[model samples]
Target: MNQNVRNHRFRKGIAGLGALATAAAGLFVGTAGATADTTEPVDPQLAVYVEVNSNDLANVADYTLAESGEAAIDMAMIFAANINYDGEKAYLHFNERVTETLENAQTQIRPVQAKGTKVLLSVLGNHQGAGFANFSSFEEADAFAAQLEDAVDTYGLDGIDFDDEWTEYGANGTPQPNAQSFGWLATALRDRLGPDKIISLYAIGPTYTTTDFSLFDAAGVLDYAWNPYYPTYDAPTVPGLDDRGRLGAAAIDLSNTSAATAADFAERTVADGYGVYVAYNLTATDQSAYLSGITEALKGESTVYRAAPGDTTPPTVTIKSGAKYTKGDAEDGYKRISFGLHDEGQIDRLYVNGVLKDLTDDRWSDLNFVKSGAFGAVKGENTLQVLDVAGNTTEVSFVLTK
Candidate 1:
C-alpha cells in the first residue's frame, strides 16, 4: 500500500493466521539471561499485525507488550522490513525505525514468542518497478528462500506473512504473482522451518478468483488468508483449502473505523466461521483501548477462538470496470465502474477509500457505478467496500494508471 506521510514507510512504501503451525522445537528456548524467555504463544485466533515505524523510540511502548494485561489475540504480526524480489530471489530491508525494533527483538518479540503468542515478521513488497520482479522463478529462490529461513531462525520468528498486494501501487508486493513460486516458497519454508510453522497469505482481490493460492492448499502449506488492505474482501470459498475457515481470517483497519465499528466487524468476523485479525498503527490510535475493546468484546472465546458461520458470509461484489480502474492518461478521461453487491442481509453502508457514498434511494444501483473523477478516485489504487446490515463485507480494489 502506498503510504501517507505521517506513517513511516518500511521502505518508502511496501506492503495474517490459520492452522496452528507447530512452534519450532527449542526455538522458544531463551539465550543466556534473556528476560522474556519461555513465554510460548498459543495458537492465535484474534490477532493484530502492527507497524513499528511511527514510534521513533518515543513514549509509545512497543506494540505487543504495550497492553497492561493479557493480550487479546495470540499473535502479533510485526513489521520488520519491506521486501523486493529480483528475477531470481527475494530480499528485505528494514526502515531505520523498524531496525530499532528488530534490535529489541529479544526484549519485544522473544517474550511474546515465549508467552505462546506467535510473533511473526511481516515482509511486504517492493516500491521499485515490477515490485516483485525478482524471485519469481522458484529455482532462483533457493538462496532467497534460504535467507528467509535464516531470518526466522536468527530473529526467532514463528513464520512469514506474504502480503503480496499485487496490482496495487506502492503496496503491490507479489513476487511476479507466480502461484507456483509462492507455493514452492511455502513448501520450502515448511521443509526448512518446520511443518508446524505457520504460513499465512493475503486474500487480496486478484488472489480470490485465481488458482494461485490453490497450490498452497495442495501443499498443505497455508494456515490462513488475512484480509486488511481491501476493506470488504470476504474469505475465499475455495475447496481443498483445509484451513480456510479455521485459520483463514479477516481484519479491520483502525484508521477506517471507530472502536464500536471495529467491535461490530470483529463480532461478525468471528461469527463467520473464520478467525479475526486486526491491523493497528502505533502512531495513529489509542493502542490500549483499541486492543482492550476487541479483547473485552471477544470475552469467553479467547482460548477457543470463534468460527464464522456460513450464514455470516459477507456480500459478493464486482467492479464492472473489469480490471484496472483508471483507463489511461489523466487527461484521457475517467472510467465509470459499474458494480453490484449481493448479501444474505441488507447492506448497511457503502464506502470507497474511507468515504461514504450517497445511498438514500435504497436501490442498490444508486451507489453502483462510480465515475472515477466524480468520486475522487485517485490515479493509483481505488477500493469499493460494501458492508451489509448483518456485517457481511465485500470489496474490490483496482489500479488506475493515470
Candidate 2:
C-alpha cells in the first residue's frame, strides 16, 4: 500500500487518546485564578531517552563491568531507545551478528519496566540520513513499523520515535510533505497498534515554522513530539524569558537550559495538551542533578528527602571489600570504598572526615558512594549522615574500621 494513502485511511479510522482534554483539565485545576491575558502555564512531563547504539553496548558493558550488569539497564530507562535508526531499513540491524545483544537488552529493560518507566523505540525518518535511512517509499516505512512492532511485542517497548532531519538536504529548501508524511505514518501506526502505544516525533524545534497538529489531534495519535534542547542546536543563551519561551528557544537552537527547564517543560506540556519528556546526554557528574530535576518535574518534589529529626530508622550502609584484601583482616590500604545505602530519611551528608565529596562525579560508580566524595578514607570510624534533598540534617553514625 502507498504509505500516505494507508496513513490517511488508518488515521481516519482511529481517534486520539483525548490527551487534550486531560491537559485542559489539568490546566483548569492548576490555573484556577488566572487572568484573561495570562495563558495557562505549560507543565510538561519530564523523561530522558538514552540513545543506545547496539554497536556501543559491548563498550558500555566493558566500561561498567566494575559496577554491575544492571547499571546498563538503569541507564536504558533514562532515554528512549537502545538502537538509533536513520530510516535506512524496515528493522534494526547490528554490526555484530550476536543475538545476545537483543537478549541482554530485553533482560536489562525489564527492571525498568518493573519500575513503570516508559520505553520508546526510535527510528529516523529521512531516507538519506545515517543510522537506518534511505527507504524509497511509504511501504518501506510500513514494513519497518511492522518489524518494529514485533520487536516491541517481544521486548515490551513502550512506543516508537520518528526523527526526520533530512528536509534541509531536499531541493526547493522546503521539507515538502515530510511533516505530512510523518503525520500520516504516525496515524497509521496508531490504528494498527491501538491507543495504548505511544508515537513520538523528533522535530527541529525552531526551524519548522508550520506543524500539522491535526495528525496529532486526530486520534491523539502522537503522544509526544520531542524538540531537543541542546545548547548548540535549539535553545538560545539569553535570559529573562518565561520558562516556555526559554524551552521553545532551546528547541530551536539545541541549547542547554538551566535545571529549571525540567519544571518549565513539565508546565508547558501540561498546558499545551501534550505529554513531555526531556533529552540529555548523560555524564557522570550531572546524573544526580539530572535525576533531581526529573524527580521534581514528575512528582513535584525531590524523591531524595532528609529524614526528619527524631526519626529512628538507623541508616544502613553495605561495604564491599575487594578481592585484593586478606581474609579476616581489615583492608586498610584500598584505593576506594564501595557501598550501598538505604536512607530512610535520617542521614544528612556523607563525609570522609569533614570534607564533602561530589556524588555526581563519573568516578562515583567506581568509588561506590551513593552521594558525595571521590576517593579517601579516614582511619577509625567514618561518619555517615542521612539528610533530605532540602539539606536538613537528621541522623549520624560511624562505620567501624575495615
Candidate 3:
C-alpha cells in the first residue's frame, strides 16, 4: 500500500471521533470513566531508542524514581553491549570493555527491567575500528555470533542489536562490500537465537538506498532496523566530478530537512513491512527534534503509537496542587483545583465536570490544571479527572469542609 494511504487509513482506525472532538474543542477533555478522549490515535509502528552509557545508566534508577507511576516509556537500549558473565565478574575485551562498565550498567539496568522496561543491549559486531574486525567470511561471522550468543545467555538480555559497518575501503571513504555477507550473518544469528528473541541491525546510510536486501530473510531473520539519518553537507553529484563542480551542482534543499526527510525514510521503510527505529544522539537535541517530526508523522496514523521508555500502560491523573482549601478566605469560596497529569504520549484534552479546559498543549511532561471556575466545597466531595492523547483517563477526588 502507498504510504499516504496507509497513514490515512491508520489514522482513521485509531482516532475515530475522539480526535475530532479534541480538534473542535481546542482543549483537553477529561472523563470519570477509565477511557478518556485522545487527540491522536496510538501508533504501534512508533518506537524510540534511549542510548545510555555507563554514566547515564548509573543514574537511571534515580531518574525513574521521580516519575511517580504516571510516565510510560518503553525499550531502553544501552550502549557498548556490555554484559556480565556473573554478578561481580564481567567479560572484558579490548575492542569494548565489558568489565566494570558493564557491571555498573547491569546493576542499574536490572531494576529497570524488573520494573518491566525492555532492555536492548547493543554490541559492535565486526566493525572497522576499535572492535572485532573482518567478519566478512562466514566462519569468522559464526564465531562472533557465538560469542554474542554466550553473552546474551549469561546476562538474560532481552535482545541483541548488531552495529556492523565492516567493508573493504572505497574511493570516497565509504565501505564497499557484497550485501549478502550482512544477510548471511543476520540469518545465522536469528537461527541461533530462536524465534522469540529480537534481531535488529543498525543500518548504514548510503547502503540503505542502494544495497541488495534480498540475501537477508526479512520476514524470518530480521525483526527491525534502525537508521541514524544523520545529515550530510555533500550534495548528490556524478562520480569522478571535481569538488568545485559538485559544490555548484543543484541539490534538493528541503525546508525542514531533518524531520521531513526522516519521516519520508521511515514511511518508505514501513511500507516495505519493516518496523523503523529512529535513532537519536543523546547529546544532540537536534536528533530529538527529528524524533518530534517522526512523532508528528505517526500522529497522522492510527495503528502506530509511541510509548515512553519506562511505561507500558497510559498515564494516570493526580492532584498535584490545590487539594485543600482554607475556610473564610476570599479564594476559599472559589476553589481553583489544580491537577498533575503525565502521559508519555501526547495529551489532547482535559475536562472538568464535562466542560473542556485548556491545561496545556501536547507534551510528555506533567500538566498542571488551573481553571477559574465556581468550584467550592459545600461540606461534600469533589472530583477531578484528566484525559490523554490515546483516550486514557485518570481521576482524583477530595473532600471540602466549610
Candidate 4:
C-alpha cells in the first residue's frame, strides 16, 4: 500500500488506516537494477517497492550495484493490486497499468527480472470490506490464495507480498478482522505456492497487531516481514523469524526520506545484524546518492545509476535457417529451428500454435535458441510468438515442409 495516499487520507480524518504519516512522507518528498561492482562487498538483500500507479516499473532496473553497472536490486515489488469487494463478492483488481504490466510480463517485467531481480506482486486492500485478514473461513482464504497463485503463475512472478490495510471491517457484511484470518490466508498461500515461492509481509495494519504470528511457520510459510512505517525503527514480533528474517530498521520513502536518514537506517540495519533493508517509491529520476547511502552503509559499496530512459519499443523475433537438427531424427521428419530473440528490455516468453512452449524466470536480452526437437513446429504452417517483459511481442508464421 502507498503510504503517501494513506498519509494524505489519514490527515483528512480517515481513521483505521493504521498510524500517522512517516516522518519523511509527512514532512518531505524525494526521488534497480542489480548491477553491482563485484570488486567490492555487496549487500544483496536490499528490497524496494515501486508504485506502478505513478512511476514506471522500468525505473527499478536503473540502479546498478556499483560502478560495474547493469545490475538489479535483489527484490522489486509491484506496489499493489487490490482485493476489492463488488457488493456480491471480493475479487483481485489490477488497475490499468498493473494489468498491462502483468499481461505483458515479457517486456516490462522480465527485463528487470533478467537483471537478477526477484519480481513480486504485492496484494493490499481497496477501502472495501474485504481484506487479507478478514476471510470468513479457511476455504475463503484458500479461494483468495488460488487467485494469487494463478496470477503469480500467469505472469511468471517470483511470489506474493501481503499488505493488510485500507479495509473497512464489516463494511458490507464481510467478516471483520480476526486473529486467524491473516494466518489462514498466509498458510493458504503457502500451500498453494509450495515451499519455494516467497510469501512476505509488510508488517503493518492487521498483520502488525494480530495474534497470527503463532500460526506462521517462518522457515517454510513466511520469508521476511518488514516494518512498513518510514524513518521509524520497529521490529515486528513474528515467530520463527530470526534477525535474518526480521527487517526492523526504518523503511525509507525515497521521495521524502533524507539520504542521511536512509543511510542511518541502513547502518542500523547492518549494525543490528538485520538481514534486509527496505526502501520504497523509486521514481524515474536518478536516486543513486540516496541509494548509495544505503548501499555504502550496508555493504561498503557505492550505488551507480545507469540512466536509461523508459522503454516503449516492442521486442523482435527472427527465424534463422540452416540450423542443425540436434535433438530429433530426420527419419521421423521432426526438425528443429533456430531463432534470434532481441529486445531493448528482455525476452520472456515464446508461444507456438497459441500454446506457451517456453518461458524464463530471468528474461533474456538478445539471445538465440535452437530447439533440439520438434517441440512446437509441425509438418505444416506454424505460428510463433515472442514477447518481452513490458508486454510487447513479435509474432510470425512460417511453413514447414518435410
Best by TM-score: 4
lDDT of 1 by residue, 106-203 (tens): 66676666555776776665454232323456565555567778878887778877654433432334433444555566667667877777766654
Cα lDDT tens digits, model 4, 215-248, are: 6665567887776766555555465554443444
User: What's the residue-level lDDT of 292 in candidate 2?
Assistant: 48
Clash total of candidate 2: 59
Q: After the best TM-score superposition of candidate 1, give how far the Cα of residue 26 lies from its true spot, in angstroms.
A: 45
Q: What would the per-residue lDDT of candidate 3 be over residues 42-124, giving only the tens digit for each residue?
A: 33233334334313532323222122431122345555552112222223232233334346545756765665555566654
Per-residue lDDT of candidate 2, residues 1-402 (tens digit): 113211211221121222234336442111221222215544444444442332222222211111121222122222222223343333453323223434676555554555445556554333223222223345654665566677667766677765444323333232234334444455557766788876655543211223344434432565544443242112211111113311321221102455566446544444433334454433222244434454454345543222123344444555556543212223443333455545445334455555565453221222253222333445445554434333544333334343
C-alpha lDDT of all candidate models, in order: 0.52, 0.39, 0.42, 0.69
Ranking by lDDT: 4, 1, 3, 2
Question: Which consecutive 10 residues in model 4 have the weakest lDDT in total?
Answer: 27-36
TM-scores, all models, native as reference: 0.55, 0.45, 0.43, 0.66
Q: Largest lDDT belongs to which candidate?
A: 4
Residue 224 in candidate 1, Cα distance off native in Å: 1.2
Q: How much is 208 displaced in model 2, in angstroms?
A: 6.3
